[model samples]
Target: MFKLSSTVSQAPISINDSSPAAQASTRLIGFGQTCPQQGCGGASTTLKQLDTRINPDNMCSAGFNASTELCVYSTTSQTACYGDNWQRVGTCARR
Candidate 1:
């Protein structure tokens, strides 16, 4: 986890669709993706949350437990790509 310090001032809360108490909360963020031979950076996409409890899909047999594991997928791709600090790359097909 990372922490950031902002220099801007804070504002008061106003309850509405944009409020914190709103029901339809968004899970959008600047997700990391590949940039081919150049590098992977400055890419953004929405994450698809996966629940191992409801749909295990052999994730538990692969040593990923529902209690501690948090699996997600890129909405734009059928397979998920992973890089270990750009040292090694691997791909896991979506089930």
Candidate 2:
């Protein structure tokens, strides 16, 4: 397991026009893709992995293979994998 560290200290939330409830309920989320594995050969057959909701702020790592998909408790757990199309192989919850 890897430990992730946030470069920014605060969660970027828009509060001006939003209601207090809306502001409180809002969360930051993001998504990204990983690189393909070595010796896999050929870009057409590659399978990269993608992480969703990996952090409480909803930041995502690059893509990864389906096999590397594991539960991460911190920002360091985020990793990058390579593949062809983007697909949701599984789901994880914040620890």
Candidate 3:
């Protein structure tokens, strides 16, 4: 759990619940290290924002609930890895 400096301004993205996940586009902001494995604290400290969408799949196979959980993936190589918590930003309505 990382804490933001008091001097830094906090502008959190808003969640768009009115629209469906498939219809809405989003940019995921994550502070994750560019490493191969988990447990590596974001020491490399890479702040990335990847454009993605909700991926539809069986909950049993993907290990995520369609009703509650959201599964998104980036077409590029960058991704939100382990140790990257609270990384879900919000919908990109402006874009």
Best by lDDT: 3
On TM-score, the leading prediction is: 3
**Clashes in model 1: which pairs?**
none
Candidates in order, TM-scores: namely 0.26, 0.17, 0.55
Instruction: Estimate the overall C-alpha local distance difference test score of candidate 3.
Output: 0.51
- Structure candidate 3, residue pairs in collision: none
Q: Candidate 1 lDDT, tens digit per residue, 11-60?
A: 54332322222122222222334443324464435443211112233533
Q: For candidate 2, which ten residues in a row score worst on lDDT?
A: 18-27
Instruction: State the TM-score for model 3.
Output: 0.55
lDDT of 3 by residue, 1-95 (tens): 88866665766645555434552565666565556576544544666666665555442244455555455665676666544432343322111
Local distance difference test values of all predictions, in order: 0.31, 0.33, 0.51
Candidate ordering by TM-score (highest first): 3, 1, 2
TM-score of candidate 1 versus the correct structure, residues matched by position: 0.26
lDDT of 2 at 29: 24
